[model samples]
Target: MFFNRKNLEDHDLRHFYKKLLFPRLVEERMLTLLRQGKIGKWFSGIGQEAIAVGSTLALEDDEYILPMHRNLGVFTTRGIPLSRLAGQWVGKDSGFTKGRDRSFHFGSQEHKIIGMISHLGPQLAVADGIALAHKLKKENKVTLVYTGEGATSEGDFHEALNLASVWELPVIFLVENNGYGLSTPVSEQYRCANLVDRAVGYGMEGILIDGNNILEVYNAIDTIAQSIRQKPRPVLVECKTFRMRGHEEASGVKYVPPHLFDQWSALDPLLNFEKFLLKAQIFSDIEIQQIKTEQKAIVEQEISSAFIETEIQADIQRELNDVYASSVYTSKNNGPSKENSKRYIDTISDALNLAMERNDNLILMGQDIAEYGGAFKITDGFVAKFGKERIRNTPICESAIVGAALGLSINGYKSVVEMQFADFVSCGFNQIINNLAKTHYRWGEKADTVIRMPTGAGTGAGPFHSQSNEAWFTKTPGLKVVYPAFPDDAKGLLLAAIDDPNPVLYFEHKYLYRSLTGNCPEDYFHTEIGKARLVHEGDQCSIITYGLGVHWAIEFQEQHPEYSIDILDLRSLQPWDKQAVETTVEKTGRIVILHEDTLTCGFGAELSAYIAEHCFEYLDAPVMRCASLDTPIPMNKLLEDQFLAKARLGSTITKLLAY
Candidate 1:
């Protein structure tokens, strides 16, 4: 039978002792590496071992863990090879990221562990997403996430708990209140009496426990996890503990009072557990020493072996391998061949409906997307077909939506997110730029997400509703930026973006949503990303543009029957069809860049710079650019009209031709 909290049986002691020993041994070995200058830095979780070891043991194999740097015990308890762990810290080729990323920023999908991004609070929201997936899939699994008390101050901490409670997700958000977040103490961080109590506001439960007590943590989690599996819900756990070391090995203990360390050291988990083993007659003092010795030997052996291991030299070519997935379409012609017709909005709706039908992993989420059918009624009748769970209507939380999408993508779900307006993407900018765009390159992490951004002006939605943000994302690597002009390309490109294995920002020009109509094939067809469509062929000059710019360029040619110019609609911005651009620019010996965004450092700047360097000899004149002024979009009718460059495109083209 089970005894009181703190006391463990003989077999429990055997398993428990290793948990206490492993992190400690690993910490000791890491300290040695720090002395030898082999490792750059180390975050010691010496006193907080119980929180990880206990919680890890309490959860099942399939349950996911999103651990921060301090949760070394979680790695050891989860059966991560000691060598792999040591190799990561030592910067060996055998590391989890193969020397690509720093230690503690690696995860194994096979092991059900999530690689944590530097911003720790975001991990909780990501864990909420993982738990959401488990619940939606009807899988009896839970997710566990670790964050410091100081990190609880981040908006994401509250956002995570709120989302979890709203959805009743099977997730446990553990706050290791180890007194400080780096150097900032908890007293300076929160005004609330206890962090766990905050969970009640989110319609969830909270448990505050002695985090240093391994048995207490284990007992709490073992029961909590079981209950969560049966009835899915978020649980907030506050584990009260202290940090024995400074933030890292190099960071001294000046901030910590000597007396405080002494007080905690006296109650050191390992020493206290040693005393319990001898007192409870679970293991003799001699046996306890033997366990420590064995654990130390293992950690030391791994560390020593890693020191001699060769590191894979950082290769520029290897880093670029998986930026975007391999091309899926084998085009009979250079561009897509359209047979049937559908409006741009219908194409978007049809493409999403078809994608959902084809791949069960694909999920659609946005504000008013469920029963409301979205703001523009683009996803009309989607909820009726796919049901509410798959076609989710989310709260107005762009950051959490994008953050959760990243987590879903990591778990092999082709997450399709809709930002109501492209201008509002700024609300989720941090998640997009930092978490979504960097995940793949930072930690060899998967970021299979499609963010639908309804972009552009001309309809007079003004600054907040009509600004084009495509230029911002094109600057970021590991991101596929798709901006289609015609309805056919919209359907085909959106489909391809859904199938893509990388993060894609699909810009759907809202102005063109109802305004533009063309022959969009009803049958299955995919427009290859990173390929420019030669909308109109001409030899005089090449007009490089995307989205609404393509329409403006074509209109410009119509107005001026004499100016012969080829309009190249670059559907994908990031890995743009540079070959076609090179071919056309060289053929015309002149180029005119047009865009809806401001002229300053726009996507046109990149093109102009490339043309200057790569196509220098072929250039007949300086590349001309026609774009909006470097100012926010105006609501005034005249100002908005002047803001758009469609009227002046003819002048710019004529000037370029004259040059």
Candidate 2:
């Protein structure tokens, strides 16, 4: 009675049945393949097929959908070839991720399908970002993102729901309550009577439906999608259903109660839908048999063809090449001759203003960035000039904001996200390393976003507010790291980071924000990413550093005037200036690396090892490293100075000179 035959035409009803049947047959065949050792794994969506198929069919082709591991019906209903899906499951080159990832872990931009990562809750935040894009462009499109009952306990889920509701984005947060999250039952998931009840807490509309009834699912989603398009706002839809199998084929369903299965077996979606069609006279019994036969034959043929396709090759060059979307910028000393004096923070603001003015697709997001002008007031007045839509003031949800920035990047928008401080990056660390850093390598999707980190110490902001964490991202494969010493390099490097079509971590030293002033070009210009600057040239010893360390080395040289030192400021960390570093090492024949982070496992360790390996023959003495003591930064000025590398720089250089 929830589904009326009059609501759909006769052909539409038959086509819907076929769409629902395809995934069921495919899942059945895939399970058999798993048993036969033909495929690696399978997440069977046997009973919950209606939710995936009906929800997918309800949306337009242009709208984006983020589905979970068990949502194969979404792919089939969207008309993805069965052969390609088979290839993906069997790890073939013909698959979306080219055998780099497994199952539905990869996304297809052509299909407008952003697949879920292993961390299920982060994708919800990604959906918020895609919906934010639609709202900004004033497009009549909605983004539907999925989550299971288990992922609801994650902080990202609450953060994403709160954000979408606050912004009133056109999003449908679909929670497929299949009774169990892995082995844990719904009773263990939450205390709420119904999952939809939590939607009211976030100030959004809530709806609950019987997921086993395909007609009801389709009708409800179709209505909700249309309504959201007319008036953009988020809605939470909870589908009540049951998982008929284990979390995956490898895990047996012994933990499930036998009576529950017996009770739900009669409510099977595919079988019930077939019975309804025959009883309603929409299809004869013979016609239903013929449709099943046709779908089975198609599934068989696609599976056979997919098995015969070429397997993934072990090409080391291709694997290495696909890690990053763009090569490092190698050109150096390219700034204009004419310049004007400006402070480091002012030049950063200037570069951002110019980049936003030139590219309408570029947007900025951070805590208090729009109205309060950010924690450092670097973006002061940005809201009035660019409007609240472009200069977004995000909630204090670091994980969701970072995920949303990635969503905007993949959807053809450039984003710049400012962390209130560098130490706070730990909150959103998973999104940066797992999602943004690995997206391109997994699926060849570039994430063109910049995360501005207010880094380093000397401001007495204590352990939480003042810390240098560049080494964390430098070790990540798909990211670029930039740290500039003066105003000129700060402006140019920020511009260059915006121009690159990859994720970049721009570390702006808080100590030098107002302290350092230098001449910068009036017009737009960009310094290379992987190039170093020679601040003071000498032959006594080479001081290799970045951020505040560069200023420390220069200050030492100015005070001594006797020992000539080659001060090399590495502007970037990941693809650092290797040639420049080697040149200085060979010229001076003594190496002294300096940094503000702890001595153990700091970036100084990486540089020292590289110099010891490559430039060992040219060295006159052992490579020396000057870094902060291996302890947390103290709040007191005297203790902080004692903990700093600058306190021991002169002594360290003196020992190296004696060596």
Candidate 3:
């Protein structure tokens, strides 16, 4: 063992002095910076330094530390330079996020510490994924993630812990139970007497400890960390402590009763540890004083240096700096598909199997995805062919599943996540929107994975199961949205999306799974993403649509053979073929934007605005939009049909023609 009981139990004076005093130095310097207007807000871990500094001693330099917004001591223990932290606080390009984020909300992939998020619970699941990767690769490393006493109430917290226990992932969850969750007391949050009891239900070991005692925290964490590295299991350690300040420096902290506040202040970890060292004869008073002086001097010097480095001297904007990157694949499709090829679901399954066969780095994760083949039987035979390791049947945890996929992607694997239904995407919204989509732009980390969303209505699944959610992904930057219409495009685009370097939300219309058929090749074929397919070309009017809308527009074309019209199937929504929309609108001198989602703020809105802004002179009439009503999908078939029917769409088209 690199470190063992004797190493820590011996308690050398040098080690004790540094751990006890470093966090204190940081707290004082940060307060100074805040008073000087250099830092805007600070969440100091003044009282809970032991849990941060000592518990982290168990982890190696390479292991990931996913910490909270207030675990500044974790940064100090992990050897994150004080200057770099100061730079981040001051919004310098030299900071961890390159001026994109401030206040502990930053990380270095190189350091393996995930940047803390404002919504903090997601990191627990992300760390579980890293631990899963280590287990798969047979690496002797453990992952540690920290959360607050109150964060246990979050859905993500349970989602992560349950997954960790099921997988026996080598992760340590250090929950800082600091009496109060912001202003609310712990009694109001959970019915349980203690947070440690929650661990037994998940089938994991749990420990409760005094958070202020550095030696006790160090002993418990190091022992558990060693066992996890060898046996690979998660352990929950609850640190009972008190937050020495308000949630943030700007907070008034008026809610804290004066008597109770003084009680905790008297037990301040730093001051208590200092007296302990003196009594134990670990260090004389003058020797301990020297260590404190040296640590304070070092912190002050780093802060002074950071102030100068982060000061504004020139325009900070870098126009050429791209938030994301892309690649253009020249997809060559042979002349035509064989007649009577396959059904929509069959092609999707075939494409996924082929991709998995071709790329060993690819893996599938979702509830019921492995043995059951997913809710729609799309991945039915995958477990036998690929085994349970590659085709994972995750717990019914959407947030954890998606968050884990991001972690696997970061570890150099291409993960494909399946949401049983599109509407369920809302359950895992934080990881998709905040972490997976924005991590690249914020910290230069890539989430190279594909999220398969079974979208669209018509199967009588009602509101929760039926809905087109393309607009949500299209609206978020750094995420690509693809909704394939034909079987050929479905097979081809799925393969392309898997290969893309960014996170791609690939939406497959559930209603068309078996109803639609096309002549697509049996082998691997790539349909270039961000390119539109001109299904039928005409010069009278243009119908711009994708997915189910393609079939609707085709119905319009067949019914009205009198009008020369072009139907464009946009394969990708985020990078929809703008050039194709422009060309078709110019050639026809009229255009209609159509989608199955609600009319307000749909992807159609953006397309309509584009045509209005750029093609105003060429248009013979104002652009028309055909969309579903702004109401929840109904359970009854008649109401759902009335919501948006082909006959009504035809009538709207005829009216547009008359105008």
C-alpha RMSD by candidate, in order: 2.3, 1.8, 2.9
Model 1 bad stretches (over 4 Å): 1-8, 325-327, 330-338
Task: Judging by TM-score, tell me the better candidate of 1 and 3.
Answer: 1
lDDT of 2 by residue, 6-85 (tens): 46898898889999999999989888888899888888999999999999989999899999998999988988898888
Which scores higher on lDDT, 1 or 2? Answer: 2
Candidate 2 lowest-lDDT run of ten: 327-336
Candidate 1 lDDT by residue in tens digits, 1-659: 12254444678877887777788888887887788887788888999898999999999988899999889888888888888888877667787767767868878877788867777777777887788788778899989999999888888887778888888889999999988878887778888999998987988999998888888889999889999999999899999999999988788789987898988887677777767777878888798888878888887787778877876787888878845545476432345544766778989988898889888988898999988889999888988888888898887878888888877886668789999998888877878887787777655677888999998888777889989888889999878899999998898898888888788999999888888788877766689988999999899999999999998888878877887888899988988988999999889998999998999988889998998989999999998888888899998888998988675787887788787
TM-score of each: 0.96, 0.97, 0.94
lDDT (C-alpha) at residue 542 in model 3: 87
Candidate closest to the true structure, highest lDDT: 2
Query: What residue pairs clash in candidate 3, if any at all?
Result: none
Q: Local distance difference test, per candidate? A: 0.84, 0.91, 0.84
TM for candidate 3 is 0.94
